[model samples]
Target chain A: MKILVCISNVPDTTTKITFSLDGKAFNTAGVQFVINPYDEYALTRAIELKEAQGGSVTVLNVGEADTEPNIRKALAIGADDAIRVNLKPTDAFLVSQQIAHYAQEGGYDLILMGRESIDYNGFQVHGMVGELLGIPTIAPAIKLDVNGSTATLEREIEGGKEIIEASLPLVVSAQQPMAEPRIPNMRGIMTARTKPLKVVEPVGQDAKTSVQNYELPPAKSGVKMIDAENAGDLIKLLRNEAKVL
Target chain B: MSVLVVIECANGEVKKSSLEAASYGSKVAAALGTSATAVAIGDVQANALASLGEQGITKVLLDNDSRLHDFVAAAYVKVISKAAESENSSVIVLSNSNIGAAIGSRLAVKLGASLATNVVALPQINGSSFTVRRGVFSGKALSDVELSSDKKIIAVKKNAVDIETTAGGTATVENFSADLADADFATAPKETIRQSGDILLTEADLVVSGGRGLKGPENWHLIEDLAKTLGAATACSKPVADVGWRPHHEHVGQTGITVSPNLYIAVGISGAIQHLAGVNSSKVIVVINKDPEAPFFKAADYGIVGDATEIVPKLIEAAKALDK
Candidate 1:
């Protein structure tokens, strides 16, 4: 079995978000980049599958050279190799097109990625890639198990979950509870240095949508601290003062 | 060209988010000098279909296929695409739900349309250039995006738009057929497990959440009681879920469910930036913590510095009194 896992390099969760002076681009200075948390679940699950099924797992990223450290980290986590579609990802459409272009020729049995990137939060890439490749795409999958050529998945919906079955050559987007992400140990870190990291030029059209500007959410007002004894008054405040009850 | 709104229903009821989407679509249609048409998915009752007129929808298209009762993305895409093509729709609106995201992306590709999800507001239409504001970076900031395609798809975020009800209006319902093929149902679910006997966290407008300060799962009744009194859903911080004090589904944070409810009440929780990222879009926030300096207070509109165990019961009593 050949499994392909896609990863995105996103800012660390705790970083304060800020845009450039012109507000057209995200400010990157002093920001620590990490593999998107959701993608970590995808990568770990792919590695687990490869370990059980005797297959090779390849990590793919559609980003510029600045994303390499995280790509190499994915290799350290257990991927056999890495492929970087050299480009600065601007939108979901272009990223999906680039992923589809590469996976079409790899003929991998499974393709996986995060449900959504933390930055864009579009949650559109997996479905688009599946449509482009003409395959079944299951998203927000919390549990996955492969048996022979069939894969069983638990996909989360609004208030429930569905147990789904699909054949090989499927696209899936991982959500949390899928797997606890694994960190690179000393041995894995040493081996990752020798792992093949191939960087290829991007093959895709321009992004369908362009950012005009960015604005920070309005600052919240100061809290109205009610005395502990007057806790009941807080209810009145929520219902009348805040008008949210 | 007309605007098409995708209405998601379950057990014969339209979802609250879908209602907001319908309202948003109709306003957009009014701006374009056209009426909004809805394509209904899932098991919807006739009354619910007709009631869409309250949200400014003038017409509803129903496929009435049993296969659609359970969400099959391929079948849904086919149904929606057929509706859009027949109606000559240039703008499509749907809720930024899991199912909506699944269908919107595929539909965008199939129709060669540009798509935007997590949209917070209506498009600022300037001739051929339509720009929309959407939440990005997990509610930390917003970005304006220009969709440069002939056809545009917008997935409205939950609680971003109000559900406007126009009085005493009824939508004309029409039968729609997509001639769905067997292949469309090939990936259909084998079984489904639904949460029972509790309000859904994602759909709730009022939420009461607890954290490690709640002590343990044994003390969860305090959270549940407050939630019950307020008719809200129960949620938890990431640490609570990670330690198995709460189910993962109830976890609300950057890596968990991102909720934009009308009111979010956090008890005994310090607001990490990650946790705040999941809920900063809330219309109002209230924090109850023993520590006065918990970060959540900075983001909250009202706060009480005390042990949640003692404060929650009093608040619950006060809430019940208000109902009386």
Candidate 2:
């Protein structure tokens, strides 16, 4: 079995979001980048599956050169190789198209990705890729297990989870309960240098969606501390003052 | 061309989010100086279909297929595609839900329409170019995206549009069918195992959620009772699931299920950005934390600085009283 895991480099979860001077782009000043937290579950799960059945895991990302470090980090963790589609991912459609183009020829048995990229939270790429490639997609899957040519997954639904069975050549967007992410060990870090990091020029696809502008949300107001013992007063304030109750 | 809205129904009643989608579609149609039509699927009553007129839907195309009652992605895509084609819809609107996201993408490809999911606002249409603001970075940031395609498909985030009630309105419901083939149910669900909860998180108007601060799984009764009284569903933060205090299915975070109910009450939860990403779309957020400095209060509409043990019971009482 061969697996392809897609990852996105995003700002750390704790970073304060700020926009550029013209409010057209994310301000990168003094920002630290990390692998999208949701994608980590997908990467780790793919590596685990590969280890269990003797296969190769390839990591893919569509981003500029600055995202290479995170791509290498995925290699360090467990991916056998990496592919970088050299372009800025302007929208979910273009990103999904780029990924589908690569997976189209790669003959990957399983294509896995985060349920949604933390940066965009579009939650559309997996379905789009599945649609583009004409394959089945089980999204936001919490449990995934493969047996020979068949893969079983538990997809999260509203009140409960659904157990789905699909063939090998399928797409899965993973969330928690799949596997806990593993940090790179010393041996893994050293071996990462020898791993192949392939950079491919993007196949042309127009980004139907473009960023018009960006703005930071309004700063939160100061805390109005009601006495802890007087909890009822807080409820009253919610009904009368805030009028949200 | 008219705007097309997909209305989902189950057990003979329309889902709340689809009504919100209908209202949203009507506004978009109004913006474009046209009418909005609805395509109804599943076991929906004709009377209920006509009631969509309250949201300004002028006509409803009802497809009463038993196989469509449960979510069959391929059949839904085929039916919706036919509806869009027949109506010559330039824009299609749907709820940003599991069904919507699943079927919307395939329809986008079949119809060659630009697709946007988790959309939080109405489109800013400027001479054929449509732009929408969507929540990103797990509720930590926002992005304004322009859908450049001539045909656009939008999955509106739940609770983003207000549910409007306009009196003395009725829509003409007409029977329609796509003549789906047997192969359309290829990926149909073999079984559906609903959890033992009174209200589903997506359908619930109110939700009572807990986090690691609840200490252990044994204390979940308080949250459950409150939810039972209020007819809300129960949820937990990722940390609770990570620590085995709750099941993984109960986790709500960037990596978990994103829900948008009318009211969300968090008990003993310190708001993590990932967790906030899921529930930030709720209309009203009430945070109850012993710690005065919990980050959840920053986004909460109401905050009570008290122990969950003390506050939750009182809240349940207040809710019970309202029923009387």
- For model 1, the superposed segments whose C-alpha errors exceed 4 Å read none
lDDT of 2 at A62: 94
Taking all chains together, each candidate's TM-score versus the true structure is 0.99, 0.94
Model 1 lDDT tens row, B171-259: 99988889999899999999999989889898999999999988878889999999998999999999999999988988998999999
| DockQ of every candidate structure | 0.91, 0.57
Instruction: Give the Å shift of residue A14 in candidate 2.
Output: 1.7
Worst 10 residues of 2 chain B by lDDT: B315-324
Tell me the alpha-carbon RMSD of every candidate. 0.8, 2.1
lDDT of 2 by residue, B201-258 (tens): 7777778999876777888899999888767789899888788877777778776767
- Per-residue CA lDDT of model 1 for A124-166, tens digit only, reads 9999999999998999899999998999999999898999999
